[model samples]
Target chain A: MSKQIKGREIHLKSRPQGEPTPGNFELVEVTVPEPAEGQLLVRNLFMSVDPYMRGRMNDVKSYVPPFKLGEALDGGAVGQVVRSRAPGFQEGDFVTSSGGWREYHVADARQYMKVDPNVGSLSAYLGVLGMPGMTAYVGLLDLGKPVAGETVFVSGAAGAVGGLVGQIAKIQGCRVVGSAGSPEKVKHLREDLGFDDAFNYKDGPVADALARTCPEGIDVYFDNVGGEHLEASIGKMKNYGRIVLCGAISQYNATAPTPGPRNLTLAVGKRLTLQGFIVSDQRHQHRRPDFLRDVGGWLREKKVKEVETVVEGLDKAPEAFIGLLRGHNTGKMVVKLASGPA
Target chain B: MSKQIKGREIHLKSRPQGEPTPGNFELVEVTVPEPAEGQLLVRNLFMSVDPYMRGRMNDVKSYVPPFKLGEALDGGAVGQVVRSRAPGFQEGDFVTSSGGWREYHVADARQYMKVDPNVGSLSAYLGVLGMPGMTAYVGLLDLGKPVAGETVFVSGAAGAVGGLVGQIAKIQGCRVVGSAGSPEKVKHLREDLGFDDAFNYKDGPVADALARTCPEGIDVYFDNVGGEHLEASIGKMKNYGRIVLCGAISQYNATAPTPGPRNLTLAVGKRLTLQGFIVSDQRHQHRRPDFLRDVGGWLREKKVKEVETVVEGLDKAPEAFIGLLRGHNTGKMVVKLASGPA
Candidate 1:
């Protein structure tokens, strides 16, 4: 006797022109493929929705390839291996893979890494202790190079990477200020994340807010929102300042390419260094051990806090991702699958 | 009884609104001041009129203080000491100081550096072995970091720094391209300076010209003219490309800020680095010895050629400055006061 298992997955229904909508995503059911030799079948537990994924949705040449129409989307996912035909991977083992937005996927064992549930929450693996965490670690410490007593400014403060950036700057013994979309996120940054100051960018002009919050001027700017945020950062930067170009969520949905900061010439007189980077760079793999050791220690010591906004069910993943672009989430936004090995 | 010698100097009659005019400058004569303790009286022979001086005309706070209204502007000048009341300097000694747009001026000995006239031509100190030379050396070597076999794109390539930048990159075994304003200047860059390729920006579209010249994409961009040139360079940069923000002649005259490069977000995907710098930074004081040794050797060996556009008489200094803005000169633009000590 033979049995077949049906699994659900989300596909890109259409390319978005401006802002993405529900119609852009389609949820479909398919027969789960049996694990072949050196492969494992994973039942997804949680999938991540990130700002960078917005770029992937567009058909453009970038560091990573664009998503094809009618194809299942791929991203960070924590899953449980239900069937395995590979060495070092077995049934009931929890692992992290790039088979996100799907209920079940057949992945080669080499493509997924086993996750130790004893470290932190499984959802945290898709967020604070995962890609977003590594981004904040490398962007702030490695690039920004915040020194003790230096003033640090972070845009998109309440989002995944920005939240950790502020906390890490604080840990580096620096003065940290942050800007977020909402008052609640601003409060979360100041009170929960231990930022020195926080402002709701929706309330006033970014330059005015930065000027008011950081009187001495920013020595390091961790740019996440870009556009006006980048302009404001340049206007407020001190001499020899460093700008870590992490992400530009503000212009992600633009149908046309947005203009850069008009005050970029200020970089000349101020002798500023603006460096753009991606987490997938080889330096990341080289520095991951140090990040795991230091940030892991900070997490265990309660010096840093983790936050996640979870959406239940695979059908809600599209809504979760769309809401993420709208700044609806307080921290890392993850979609929780209905069933797993547990 | 002693007759006082009159000193002729050019003063800023009015701050320019956009493009400078002859009316903005006033030539006046004043009695030459005597050299006090630790001071020297110099009879100017040659003075440099550079693009960066335009930024000083505006009443804005920058790395260097703005030029005061109705005052003789100061820049790199080579002069012979007519009289000296300070140690380590004597009459007829050729020296360099920030005393420009004047026939005669008084300077503190500490503000002047004694130049060995035997090392190179007296004007050579103002071009090849001076600020322009050091600017080319430091900006290309330290900031731009053109590795051997990399492609370097230089804007305003026939100008003081750009010409030298291309030659130095060639010395480093790089494929170098340049963009100048006129066909004559383009010919100078390719024919005289030995750049691998060059284009006349005024001929057609900068993007098209860059695409034609930089087939493999620009690995290092020495930005001298900003706005369109900077935009085109950004569009053609290779992954991990470096931009040395040296000068921005294109925007220095604008009454309003122009739009920046529209495709700055490409930096994120390409992992590009754009750094702005000023030659006056302390790093120069430290690296000056190395610059002098290497560039001086190159100059002595005739491996590099020096060119200067001499606008005779102090009265033509304003014309020289305005012509410089219009990209009239083939190389370093200098105003000749008269023959030096020789």
Candidate 2:
């Protein structure tokens, strides 16, 4: 009976050269999967549209495998376990998995993690309480190594990872500054995110803006946009500074090879350490319990605020993802698959 | 009586656009000066010819000041004190100072370090026990962070810094490979430096050589020639490899802006860390004591051997430096200003 139910799915139609086109995706109806031995049948409540998914579309070798043409696209998703063949999970349990961009998914019990709806909103598990939040926490604290009274600058400040990085650095007693593409995003960063200063990189030279905001010099630079942001950050870095290369959104859609800063020689004179890291490489894996505990407390105490943009349906996921690449979203972007209670 | 003695000096006549010429240097004569308060009058013995001096010739912002035309060129030198006015140092003592390209120099006593005659040869202090040695030790161990059983590659294998770096990595239980310009240097790297493998970079494509030599993939890369050597190293680096950007000898003479490698995006995929460092900025200041203690012990124990090209007179200093920039010398290049005790 479950196999007869139809599910909406999105599959990769072609590889993108620069910005992805709508034609690169194919929306189709497929038979909904039934729970097999040790598996759970999930009704997806919310699906995540993230920047990292862009790399999967390319054929180049990366940390993650490239998404193959004619295969369903997969990313983080919040869902409800409608039926379970595994002992660990039961019917009506809220869960999350590396689920496809679809209305329903079936996976082994081990792949789906139980989500506590009582803790917060279900979408929060896909953003602030999930991978993006963890990336910001680990990348800034562990790799960036910001100290008290130091000036910490973050690029892509309106995005999921950047927004959390700014707040976390501020909580660690650093004077935080951020950069975004528009005036509205800059306003959100300064007014809502508690960033000490914010700037629109689209308006003027980022290096000049950095020089004006960080008079003393930047101690730790958490870079989300690599190309020009990396160059500008290199110029304003103080002696013995640290730069964390977490993401490179600026170069994702670049049609040609991105020309990096010619003044990278400054790294020697400044005694700078420019490290490129992925959150999965962080040392404290078993410490996540403590992380979620502390971050959860901080959220309740109003120390760190969460910001997100919700697109109404799974049908709009490709559009939302494309908008994310163009800096159209204010914060974490998620696709709402179901209305209210799971 | 000191004022009556004539000193031979080499002055910078003009800046060179590419390869330096004899016209770029002027050999002049000046009267030797008497020792003043807290100063020592020294008869120079050996002066070092290093690749870093090439940067000083250009009118660009760097770690050190540029060589001003019409002024005498200065560098690391070993000398015998002829007269002294400060406490602790005395006449006939062998010492090292920021001695200029001259037969005689008046140096502040505080600027000179007393050398132990028991520590092999005085010229060793100008190479293995000096800045180049410290640079190799700190940059490889601290920044490159080569672990035992890892593969390490060093460019400019015949030069002072690269030779020492390869040997030190070997001592740390790493498999060391090196790239040099000539067959003789390659032979020297393999036979004399005890490198696991060595190649002549001028023979073929460096990336192919690297791929052939480093099958397990390079974990640490000590970069001395940045352009093509850096590009090759990046291609063969393993996940989480570390690259120490010690110098870029290839681009120092480049008239136009050097175009960076097209595959620079590999840094993000491999999660590699590329850091530029001047040995002077090392966080661990005790490297001097540690280096002298360890390298001095190694010399006595016959664990490491050093080679040097000793030029005849102070008049030849400028030519020797020019030759060094052109890769004319193997091992450490130094100038002998006066006859030794023999």
Candidate 3:
């Protein structure tokens, strides 16, 4: 109880009007509180920056509460337990919690889930074997329901979830095509991720690229970037196609309301099925074991690879997040809060 | 094979640019050929005009093929077998077939299904007991999946398919709300069709009207008129809601593509599902018996009432179809070709 330590944490300085800036976040020094009864004190090693956080910056009511101004912004983080006043937890135990954007946190031990350090790198828990990974796994398998021999198309294919989505579709014996913002991302999709075809949507019309790449028509679409990408996917969908509404990163930073795809009416004639979902929904809890088993097996077999862009310090979290919105990251964007046990 | 009779049939003179005009259809007199072996010569008593027909009028690839220029348009019609060379069909037998917009047709008997006149009126086979009725049955129950006590909202509630959707939801023990084009249609929805609430969409903003009517938010939305109605329904949907995409009568005649609901992105956070379908899909064929049993029993018990707007004469079929797109008909809109046996 006498031992005291200082730690740095990132707080929401002000809500962004549209596209977030570095000034919207502030780094401040704070005391790392001692673990209370039934609680544990954790020293965070890594914190994740995701596209969905932009929606919480707004004051509107959503599935999750908005980030309060001048308060610490929270998300996925992985850390090691430094002190524990709770049962079933010991010093040096690695765990993941929704206490990100900080170097350390003290909370009830139940709030954290222990992770296997031997399975993946500590940062991998925040990306590949974590929220983003589960999103890709469940969204594609449970919702998209891509069958073998069917053509599956994904947008933002170089990102963490999209990259895994393409690989998983290939594993299911499907023809996979992907679209990304840059030629480098497209090349990575084809050569590294083994997508059947990849295209840089910025070079030409998305519809033309889809037409040339997916001549057989898309049976499933993993939508990471909405707007133009969604419109083109709908136009090219085969009859009874499934569109997984995973993320709409392209429209998150728009100052004004973004227009939806104009050809959406084609869903009727084509009998397409479009579904949107949240990973944390109670209905998805039962599928977690399946996700862990399948994705975990893939990692061990080297069938799915983990890709990440890491920033050095918690102070640079705002920069990392802003860059994430700008599509600067090749995969998952995470900030390294502290060095874990060597 | 020598007996001949004069009959009038409608032909697609040209493709309409936007809204269809009377000039696009040409009524021409033709000789009715005698029935060949395994064929039946039928005299049509009634013909159906549905919103889906508008899509076929365009020279585009859809679920059904586009009508060829100078060829007689075909759709659902109820008729009596005037002469038969087929073993299954007999003279004076009533049947329904895809040989509409004509006074007489000679086709293989396999193309037609015999109808029991005691179940409903001859024109009801073209409306309530026919294709439109089945569209409502399968779309709402199979796709929408509205559970009892859930709130179901339907657009184009006065039209053929939409009207049946509302009543079916009521029979499922759901709180049904509906939107129509006119005051009379709205009143009919609330009073005669037993909808929980009804609104005239032309009287005010659809969003405001939906907010007022569906205070608890919608669990299922049966979409017939797309455009504004679709957008409003999406905005008012509760979490995990199902949207049945039946028709987009609002945009069927648009010269340019219509934009989808901007709030469609909310589907991700709310976990909504949207599915579109055609009634003739092979997958739905197995559900015909269930539809006939439930809807037929409802008709017999007077739990679901049959309502129709009839246009006289085969020459008026094009006008009836054009009026259907303009929201000029309440319930089902059908054209009477001739009188049935007294």
Candidate 4:
């Protein structure tokens, strides 16, 4: 017999023209969904706020579908499996899934991955041990193809993906440099993240900063914030350099057509390759085990440090998400719905 | 013994402000001397006038060196080895080398490749079997990676590199479409070169032309004239489409920065990979045999057609070279030296 329970849900009220305001989101009380055949009912502990979500907020066709108005927005989340009707999942197990911005979600059990609590914190699975970590690993290693002694430049260095990218590049014996928005974030990148150098992008011209840090030229550039950062990286790229376009947080909320570097002619002169990627396209299932093992080892060894802005209560998620867009959060931005055992 | 021979040489008198004028070139009488210890005396037969040479005429740093004023402008050419002190070359041997705008010159034997008459015409080596042919083969196959049944769009369809790219893409079982400046070139692309469809780019807006021809979004865009054509291709490209940037002939002589498509944001939305390449970087000695064999077979089977505007005499070389920049020539534009046998 299915049990009915009350759940807190956040729905899209309206599409934002530029920067999303509170009016765009609606918090509502709803009956928790019951698991159908081969489904699992989960109680979410933490929800992820990502830059890529901005693309979904707009009514535009992209790699992923746009978020519908008056519907619950869905993304990566860590939860406890309260009930299960599938072979793989059982009650009381910790898991992660593309669950809605809700206290409880009923999803196909196959979509939810069981997490090992002994390895790390359950929230860490939503950030470093999850999709964001895999995105950084495959995008840089497979596409960027960093060789030893190469200079790797990463934008949004303090974010979940960028922060891990710098650390991974360092493990590969690359001279890793990064750019973040604030001095505090830059300090974290240099001190804790093991970046060879870090710069505050807001301080001065990015090209000048790149010149000072990367005297030779950048061999690979992992672009998280596009527009001017892409232009600056283009100017300072070595011959045959590869640019991994992970995200463009800089232009996500731009009301007008974003003004970008018009000097794409440099791509020809420099013999550069600029590739845009969606993490889902990378075939995560086959790679997930290896990724978990590798990144898990790095975390345990303290080679890769992770920082998170843990927003308490699901009610504060929209503000935390907005804060992420404004570069106010360091590392992974995750909203906590419950007080943990600690 | 050092012997002197009379030859006609064209010198860069001044750099052109916009479109290079005939006044910029000064034809002068020069003494062609004998080969040094490791050099060969080559009697230039047919010289190529390619778009990439335009970049070398300017003082700006490029893949190759800038053209020096009062010195003979150099480009790829088919010639006959008259004398050789180097072990690799011999007298009366047909070869391809970077022969300057001159009747006869002493070249390093190491710099020239011996052309086989059994493969194709000696002049074909200057266009189809040499740099331009390799450019199409490597750039399209390596960068574009056209799969069977994919739609491929090419700009500058009648030019040396573009013409070959369309045919090569077709050979790979791709549905190939191209854009040319004239009706004759358009006809050549469709009727002679085996392109699935072709259009006159000068007739109307490229986006409109692309929309009409490419109902299925472009899988690969081989860009030779990158201005409006590049922008149009960007709009038509499918998800994960590959853009092989071979050259930007349209923007070479641009006085002001050519205002490119402001909608480069489409790159992220479509997840396009835009790459630029120079053929020399990908070339290795081992690849030449296979390249010549495959491209040579296509030439002999008449699956591919080679066309050229053979301007008579070295004195006409500068005019032909300038004509190439203005899109005055069809296919490969070549200057025939008076001192060589036809």
Best by TM-score: 3
Off by over 4 Å in 2: A1-4, A282-284, A340-342, B1-4, B13-19, B59-61, B67-70
Query: What are the per-residue Cα lDDT tens digits for candidate 1 across A281-312?
Result: 99678988888788778888889888889999
Task: Write the residue-wise lDDT of candidate 1 on B177-253 in tens digits.
Answer: 99998888888888899999999998998999999999889999999988989888999999999999888889989
* Residue B293, candidate 4: alpha-carbon lDDT: 83
What TM-score does candidate 2 reach?
A: 0.94
Q: Give a tens-digit lDDT track for model 2, residues A200-261.
A: 99988998999899988899999898877888888899888888878889888777877766
Candidate 4 C-alpha lDDT tens digits along B1-342? 455687888899998888889999999998887688999888888888888878888888877889999899888888888888999777888888887587787877788888886777777887888888888888898789999999999999899889999999999999999999999989989988989999999999999999999998899999998888988898889998999988899998987766555566677668889998878875434566777888989989988888777888878887898889888888888887744542
Please give the ranking of all candidate structures by lDDT, highest first, separated by commas: 3, 1, 4, 2
Error of 3 at B50 (Å): 0.9
lDDT, residue A156, candidate 2: 96
lDDT of each: 0.90, 0.86, 0.91, 0.87
Compare the candidates by lDDT and give the number of the best one: 3
Estimate, for each residue in A41-100, the C-alpha lDDT of model 3 and write its tens digit: 999999999999999999888889999999899999999998888999988999999999
TM-score of chain B as predicted in candidate 4: 0.96
Rank candidates, DockQ, best first: 3, 1, 4, 2
* lDDT digits (tens) for residues A186-273 of candidate 4: 9999988889999999999999999999999999999998888888898899999999988889989988876555677778879999
**CAPRI tier for the interface of model 3:** high
Model 3: which residue pairs collide? Answer: none
Least accurate 10 contiguous residues by lDDT in model 2 chain B: B257-266
